[model samples]
Target chain A: MTTTAHNPAVESHGHEHGHAEHHGPRGILNWLTSTDHKVIGLSYTITSVLMLVIGGALAEVIRGQLANPNGHLVTMAQYNELFTMHGSIMIYLFAGPFAFGALANIIVPIQIGAPDMAFPRLNALSYWLYLSGAITMLLGFFVTGGAANFGWVGYAPLSDAVYAPGAGADLWIGGLLLTGFSAIFTGVNICATVFYLRAPGLTLFRMPIFTWNLLVVSILILLAFPILTAGLVMLYADRHLGTHIYSVAGGGVPVLWQHIFWFWGHPEVYILALPFFGMVTEIIPVFSRKPVFGYKGMVFATLTIAALSLGVWAHHMFTTGVVLLPFFSIMSLLIAVPTGIKLFNWIGSMWRGQIWFSTAMLFAIGFVVTFLIGGLTGIYLASPPLDFFTHDTYFVVAHFHSVVMALVLGGMAGLYYWGPKITGYMLNERIGKVQFWLAFIGTQVFTIPQYIVGLNGMPRRMAVYPNDPEWQTLNTWSSVGAIMIGISTLLFVVNIVASWKKHPAGDNPWDGHTLEWFTTSPPPHHNFFRLPQIRSERPTWDHNHPEAKALAHGKEDH
Target chain B: MRIESKILLWLGIFFGLMCAVYWTWSLENAGGVMMFFAMGLCFLPGLYYFWWSRRMGYRPEDDPNATQETGAGYIDAFPGSSIFPFTLGSGAFFVVLSMVFGSWLLIPGLGLVIWAALGGIAEGRRGGDK
Candidate 1:
């Protein structure tokens, strides 16, 4: 509640000098060898953004090829590799690590009042493993057969040794295996930190929403990632050891790959999604000037969603006809209930509250609107009949793009929201708004036509389409949208560089409600100088409004 | 804890009944049954917390004005510079690379992994290093 500009505690501490004196290892060596959580988090974030640029360039290639029917932009094999590496890079290298590795590492321990992770060495190992994995995966581009072209899921028989027959596929499996290990290490660290490192007065129900979400994410990573790792191990065996796990000619069932992959795959969506949900949960309340509405409902909803996520894996396998139709259908539909509850809670938090339309808030609201469309279409695809028609089509492509757009936009919101704290400078708001609008509009413009083409019986993952004039027009519009997205990303870079030292953002730029805001902007080596007395979930709120009402005992239970 | 457990207990009962209905209609309804079971298991944490809280009485987290000592203290000791992370990363890369190149690379890969893992664990015990 105490403003950063006026806080005597911040002035007295002189954290920058004190921090450097205590925490040794200066310069680039510090970055490579340091065990500090903040340094590791920044490294993860920087790497992810760079990966995003690489993935986006591949996307531009895909769009350029699709601009015209029977276009000669790329061969069929090149197209396959482009899409495969694009999805793989974005999911494995960017979104997942950006959320869990970068944001959670920096934010969770601070929120819980822990100075560093439970296992700092393991944390550093996780980052190094991730980087090594990314390099190995990208190494495929320079190889003989190019990158693995079996799509991101790497569905079997197609991904088998007979079909793939190269070191590229091997590299894909090995890269993912290493990243899987990285995720497992980070997941263990997060779970241990949450359980053991919480501050005084920070109980289970009283923890911040972002911390709660990360806890569930850690659990999901711990339980779900090993399945993919095991599956990938089998895939490697089939490719190199001449095993018959997925090869149909060798008396193996290819659909078994689908089952194993989607089991991990479905939960993987939530791995990327839940953190954004947490970001929006944090952003909405701060901008709305309200405590999160229906706090217990939000928690229960998040838990239920994670549980249901495990059961709904077969929804992706619905069109394969090997899965149980009614069973997967019912479970998938049921997931909508908990997800809808979260949407309602977000709106309820904003209802009749004083609203500020900061760029971060705009993106959070954008996430809500965008993700709703994705969730609804997901339900539509949950139906066995609809899925059978739209299977492997542009509709499915549009659906996932919408969902991923939500995650990416929400992540941007968090980046901007926490920019002041992370960098000690406020981002230029005018440029930020321009970037957000371009991204929002461009995403809609790009994906809406894909749905139209999908309904008109166009398949996905094709280098060239039939020479229909209508298809060309739609593809052209979509390509324009892709260019817009690219420009918007450039604007983000401009904003970062443009505002590097223009404005010094003091500690609590947004009057934030969480514990991280209580510390200085770009917090010291040890995060907090003196801790606030935490009573409830909103410790800063309690600090600010001491006499608003007698502290409501177990109000979070409501 | 008591309040949340009681709420989830009833919610679990409600979902359990729904699972029964779905199970009766289709005996092959594994997804519905499993989903409901998972939902029911979500209540276990709340139940455990409720029992733990009742037995232990109030902790520092439950009281607003608890003293600083009641809180979990400052961070435990952090490790200084070590080559374990780099060595472990190198070991993993080579192991993966061996899958492509040949079995000969596996020897050094496995050795580095073993050395790094052992060294990382031992590095923590050297007192006053950091």
Candidate 2:
């Protein structure tokens, strides 16, 4: 390891002069074959955005069909296809990939000061696998039966070749297996990089909140996604291999699908959730002008949630009459404690501080408020008796939309927060704020009406409903809110286009503390020039204001 | 590294405890075994880190006296560029299509995977192309 005449550390290392020597080739080759994490990450985000558009369009069709009861805008079969693709694309394609695939790839390595992902080529491979999987799934739209209508969960007997009997069902299985494996590979890389490649002095406790979240999330993904893959394989076997794993006529238990799916499904919530929670955690402390209230508590709470999520899958299956009610109900309820701790930590961080309400901060605040609603409503779902009334109702729909606010609002916050850093361009603040408020109001208008209708016994995933006046009014208003959301999302794209390559975001635009802000706005090929002093979690802030007591050097908040 | 290993060790112990509790709570539930695998997942990486940290001793980061410049050196050699990822993905894609298209794809699908593996390995052994 010594520096010699041929030392890469001196002549070739180039850190003494600053930055790694090459930026590599430009244009398509760099994107296609280069193993740079940033390129792959940006590819992930872009693909998710494209999928988001497709998923959103499908939502509009669903709303169009449901705006009035007994509506016939789409064929009944097409309505089924629309909702199924909407859920699958939003969950598997947009939400999960954007959080874990894009955000983790972009931030984790930089946060740890690693040169690149542990498997740089595999990182690139993830993007390709993701793209091909997405295409494979989208290919269903053109097939004869017009995509899988068995629902995103693809429950048993319903999803069998006998019931579905479409190429779409087979395509759905193939696409997910590829994307699922892609995710599992990404998890392995993140785990390896974080465990093995932290910068000197960046100890476990000293790692950034986002990095900590990635570590736990990678573990969650590794542990959870494989079950989904295995389950899908069994489903495929039942479909193509002529097996009876889920077919009742062949002596298969239908509840087995519920067991297998929920085992992977429940943890998938946290797998998608923990990273945005990480992003919000990072954004809150920075804009609040304080160190995080409980860094260690945040870490432990994240770990606790991951552990509890494992045993609580049965909570989703309580209505099936097969789940152990007490054990799962208790475990599911215990998750609230850790989640509550995190909420309080965020609130405490903002107390009495010079809070800057940037668009990112605004989204973070919105995420906090909405995530609370999502979590509290989940209590009813966790109870076996209570769930009997609400399962498969619009109450569940409202709950889901609220829960994904983390992915929606929290994701928007991360985009505003990190988007500048990634692109080296500042998004228009005025436009961003306007989009934020519209989306905020639209989300409330959208979900609250559903809660009312659901309690009135309006079932979910229904294309046409009986014409009832109250249900009609609520349903129409919900469609209005969906359109508002649609417009606000379009405005976000306008902001991106308007801001691109215009106003250059100088390094440390937010005056942040993490290792990411220590480098350039977009950073370099190697991600660092000269390493900043890594004394504590707030490295950049420490380097800038050496004597600052607030988020100062060497001050660990126990 | 020391703290990370300890944290993961505790998490491993925690998940292991849950596995035992869930198993004792319900003998026929298969989800208990999932918890067992979760424990093993944590311990495998956690213990590997623990052993390696002990073998290599504390990095300069863990040493309080280490200065900013102490970590200034060559990072690992990042692969400049590689086409095998695309090749490997294509290979895997064809294999996935085998699910829809029948078993005939087993030949070329697996063949490309093997080809990419050999190419990637040879490139790594030869220190990769310039």
Candidate 3:
């Protein structure tokens, strides 16, 4: 092995001494107080997974109630709280944080060839703030009024003090404010690290797709989250201080809340999805044994998607009648082009390539197929005429579920793909594959019928429906599917535990293409023993194939 | 930056054209205003990156096998345990609780918040000397 005498910044921090000493901090106190990105990342992942279980439990309750017509699983009020908390917990607490907070914190530094985030202390702060927010949100359940019952959107007038006079909604507002601050902090950390950190020879274009996606996610967070934060403050004032931010009688239009909320809400959808898309982009190419096809196009398309995302907020408000429908509709349609380009590029990468059917690849393929369905259905909803019919219906539910499920599946794929790198233990492949199939099939079974019933004029957030046989039948099937999803999630936990001690994954478990793979499995505290010579976008590939420049240029295809 | 600028420049033009079309369709609506603003925002970043990249050419990040000197010798420094994060979290908790409970908690909550913020800045400066 050649050791290049490089700058002092590239020097390892006495890595040969051993892992324990150099990694810094130990015991329970260290976890609570440490600024190590890896520790913070693990903390974030654990918290998000716990929240996933809590949120998923809420979903089970919802499915149980909807299983039978006029079901008395709980009263209407409890039903409202359950569903509201379900959406809020899953979106705010689980998906967004899991993707950007956990995955990004763990992977971005290693992928970018940096030791840690730019502001490690701020990174720690972000995690603690997030945990605080999660606690506060859950605290709403113990309060007198129950958890926020105006749905997760907490649309105004309904959420007003007159209508919802209690500490529950106030708690919801407080929780979200903290979480928004956490997100903004994390966003700043990510942007700064990517801008300032990066190993030599890793240019903006040469960076891995996942890091690129995170960069865009950071920008979107910085720009979009403050709007939500401001809106929350205003709502809090309206409720507690008797101000009239959203009260129509007080000259404040209730619709103003929709404008502010969806401005953050729509981009919030992308904040969750882009990281998943980036993960899939990275996973597909590596398993297929090819460099990502059209790497530049992938980067360009991601940025374009992000830019267009800012302009499409009104698409969510089309049925509100206040939004200019044509503008939003056109922007929504245009946003699809970049997304379509990504799908094409993914297929192009897998084209004629030695595609592996690993658990990760299976989920990635599932994401592509599922997200395509989601995106296409979204096109129908983007049109004002069509949206008027389906808005707040199960069709819309099915559509967004498809989208969110794709994101969740993508996150799972990333976890499996990077499990070895993060934990030094390969997840049990057979069990992983089983979990993947169950989840995929279960999600489809659960959500597909939502579209059918929705088109049949079933509204969303409804506690009960008329005793119609067809609706009952569809709802029962959906509940069964939901059960399958629950069982699949349990299998995933079992796989993690069962494989915890088995199959010690070596450094390059999948012969990965990026810098992170060049290091030890569950990489050392300093990330690298000595950094590899980067020659192109595929640094590890270049290091391994020094004599095969032609292969690097794609002249000799696999 | 170079590649980013080119991509953004073209996207700006594309959105600019879209704005024209939307404007022609609806002259005095929120949609046109949004499209017009998008066009402007897109162009600003596009031009900035282009200008910045031209000024700083052939950087280490742009070339493979380049010496690692640019980003080397900089092991990330980790700070020891500090109380500010916990205190800040406590401040947030009490402040929120004050809203639900009463105005009495507000004084302590805001006081703790200010105390934590000042302590956090000073803590870092003190650590630098050590």
Candidate 4:
């Protein structure tokens, strides 16, 4: 328990303590042990990039096998491991850390005008723990029994030691347990920071939409992940100690795992998507040169999405033969309202403004287009009968990939747009546009036909499809598209590295309105030279000029 | 800054020590429910010191103004060292001792004691710094 520390510039009658800035170590040695929020953020970004490449390579190998029906490039064991690692690495290591964790570490403090994350050293600890978990799980690949093949879900008796009989399952559970702890610790840190660390005059209502979205996300992680920890611990007990948490013969219920996993898993979708919502909110306002449409409404909608996310886990469990469909259906439909609100907000934010088709904006627009199709199809999958048809089919695969691709692509857009500010250098826009188009076209070429293939009754996770004439053309096209997508991803890496040092970017390259833009590009050890006065959500807007301020604030009375 | 924080600090230490003892006792007894309960107990003193510190008028550890962007207190609370010391050390200590000593309850029981002692000592020191 500590006193609420007030910024030096703000002279409240509150008591203040003189803090000695502790500089522990120096150089790369310092970075290795460094607790700086920015350094930790860089660590997250670098780790995520490496994981993305690893996961993408796995995807390529799997797609190569499935390129043609019954293509014998890999054994079933190899395919199962590939898909499992692909899903786990992409979701946990790539999307989770890179998108929210990295961005939040870098930007959230800046957005709120705080100097750094509330817990910088703990921030470093969370990243290390996450890396450890990810590495341990990947190491299972080289083990004697191979990796866990019960899918990333690591479902019951199939994952049981008796049925699976391997050290792989133990490793899987252990890795996830460690990862779950990291997520929770990071959530705790973020929540505390957001609650207690806002600069003077920066009220909750005045916080940026991205910060608001992350606030809801942090809460969701806190509420959802602890249960996942509990569930993983139980599963580990069953695997190693002969406990019967999921064993029916031992009086344990197998369906219990599904309930616990999806409870966390469903919110995990929002955990992934909500930050994209935040980035979209940020991008839309900047490109349009307009205040975000319905800022308060967007905040409310984000919170609603996080809240309703908890009750809809059963939607994924519908085909499991034991789900409360009525409850799940109601919950699922309820989620649509908030999601639809965000959709309208994005569209409304872009309405009638001078739309700049920057590579960043292209991905934002791409997200909206792809997410719509994905959302509509998601509604179909929410239904019990429809899900039964789409269950295990390429249709389900198509719908999910669409949603996830839109989400991750939006994240990529945010990353590139903000990377300059974070690094104090501009990306190679020429190569950026190339990479964007390649990814945009590659996604469509690769995934759009997945819906058709799924409808034609192609089961997912199969290394080889039987010689069904209907699935051939689309499957071949999808595989080719995947290769293109992989190439584009590589170009994105090249573009980032090539321009890392040479390109120059100013503090406000996009002329953004948020508080983050008020500081130096890449900022300093302490984010701001002197903490600026915060009146509204957009502090930089006020500091930039009084005339621009009047334009934004003018609508207050109107 | 105040006498109350010092008292609360020692109070935190006392409860922390009690928690450590209770946890170790539970581990040596090999009671699964008790072991779980002990883990929960470990969170109490850290929380109490945190609460008491705030009440006693110390700015929060994470408050940028209080920490001065140097992150001194953050590391003290949650150290990045491998938690396997708690997990594996305790798990192994219990399993091995039970096997060698032919005492089914001895290893897990002592394992719990070790976990409680270590966790309590670390957390207690974090609060004692101020």
TM-score of each: 0.90, 0.95, 0.92, 0.81
Leading candidate by TM-score: 2
lDDT per residue for candidate 1 within A385-494, as digits (tens), equals: 99999999999999999999888889989999988888899999999999999999988888888888988889998898899888899999988888888888889889
Off by over 4 Å in 1: A1-21, A545-558, B1-59, B62-67, B72-75
> Any runs in candidate 3 off by more than 4 Å, and if so which?
A1-23, A550-558, B1-59, B75-83, B126-130
Per-residue lDDT of model 2, residues A1-558, tens digit only:
011111112223445544455546678877777887888999999999888888999998899999989888999999999999999999999999998999789989888777788888888888888887898888899989889998899988899988899889888988999899899999999988997777777777888888898888888898889999999999999888878888888998878888789888998999999999999999998998888888889999999998888889888777777778898989999999999999999998898878999999999999998888889999878888888898889999999898885469898999999998899989999999999998888888888899889988999999999889999999999999899888888989999988889899988889887988877878877677556657778778888877764444335543
Question: Model 1 misses residue A481 by how many Å?
Answer: 1.2
lDDT of 2 at B61: 61
Using lDDT as the yardstick, the better of models 1 and 3 is: 3
lDDT of 3 by residue, A180-292 (tens): 99999999899878866778878787789999999888877876788789889999889878788799888887877887788788889989999999999989999998888
Q: Name the better of 1 and 4 by DockQ.
A: 1
Candidate 4 share of real interface contacts: 0.00
Least accurate 10 contiguous residues by lDDT in model 2 chain A: A1-10
Off by over 4 Å in 2: A1-19, A549-558, B103-108
Candidate order by lDDT, decreasing, is: 2, 3, 1, 4
The candidate scoring highest on DockQ is 2
